[model samples]
Target: MMKYLRYALLAVAFLLCVTVALANRAPVTLALWPDTVTAFLGFGYAVTLPLFAIVGGAVGLGLVFGLVWEWLREHAQRAEAAKMRRELEQMRRAHPETAARGATQPPRDKVLAILDEADGSS
Candidate 1:
């Protein structure tokens, strides 16, 4: 049911985008700089593209930049998580009794219990 809902939402979004593209079919000129600045510098550039293409390209670029920024911002948290995992693994290796105690304890969930049993058997 959730999967179907997600698909439905995606379809709606696609249709919306298609409608926007069709509605904004006019060509627009994009310039790197103003006409005066270009004349003074003698190195201005411009390109003609559909309005939808420009808007979509800007949105796509923004999404990519946001993703990259978020990933970079979380670098410290990711590093700390990795460090904790390594420390936990080292502690488990160093203390056989604690590891055995943990293994002997029954899991709270049926799925986890089944997984533990499978691990023990293997």
Candidate 2:
């Protein structure tokens, strides 16, 4: 499942690169810089490229945002795991008997421990 998602994302990236190349190759000028004319030199006009620069810029920005989001997610998960570990340790320290009994036996022996205690008392 994970591998398939990765392959899909890679395919999308490849397609995006292809699209950018094709769009840039469409033989349209995105920006025109004019020189040697005093009034025209300083003035600039916005013209259309073969495809909108907005599209290419959006794709690039999306990829960056996705990578950053994934990194932050994994970091947050790791921090949460460490916090839970610390809490468990503090809890064990506060309950000496529970900690000792838990250490001496496997977790599956919980019911057996209760039964043994009952039998001993009776």
Candidate 3:
């Protein structure tokens, strides 16, 4: 089933990540400036972290940025959808009779409506 296949895939991915982490357990120094620049500036920041941690952090940051970018790009669509919903509500309130009739109307397909009635599942 799809559920089992998905679980197996997830397991494989987890194992791969674990293997990578174990293989890259050595500490890596992350420096903000070159040695010469640091010497001239008299101040530089650096942190030592496991290579796996750095790699994972970069991947996580990329995902976060991508999500934010997409949300920003879709802002207009979201705003338009909200505007249309408000307009629909206003129209529904303005014409209560039409809204009621629309709700009671049968499906567009006459054959489907007949079948639904016959099955008593309309």
Q: List per-prediction Cα lDDT, in the order shown.
A: 0.98, 0.78, 0.97
Off by over 4 Å in 2: 1-20, 27-56, 66-82, 94-122
Local accuracy of candidate 2 as per-residue lDDT tens digits, 2-120: 99999999999989878767766554444545543535667766566555455666678999999999998799789999999999999998998999987898566878989999999
TM-score ranking of the models: 1, 3, 2
Full ranking by lDDT = 1, 3, 2
Residue 116 local lDDT, model 2 = 93
RMSD values for the candidates in order, in angstroms, are 8.3, 9.6, 7.1
Index of the highest-TM-score prediction: 1
| lDDT (tens digit, per residue) of candidate 1 on 16-121 | 9999999999999999999999999999899999999999999999999999999999999999999999999999989989999989987699888899999999
What are the clash counts of all predictions, listed in order? 0, 0, 0
Query: What is the per-residue lDDT of model 3 for residues 1-122, given as tens digits with 9 covering 90 to 100?
Result: 99999999999999999999999999999999998999999999999999999999999999999999999999999999999999999999999999999999875898886887999964
Residue-level lDDT for 57 in candidate 3? 99
Assess the local accuracy of residue 117 in candidate 2 as a C-alpha lDDT between 0 and 100: 95
TM-score of each: 0.85, 0.33, 0.83
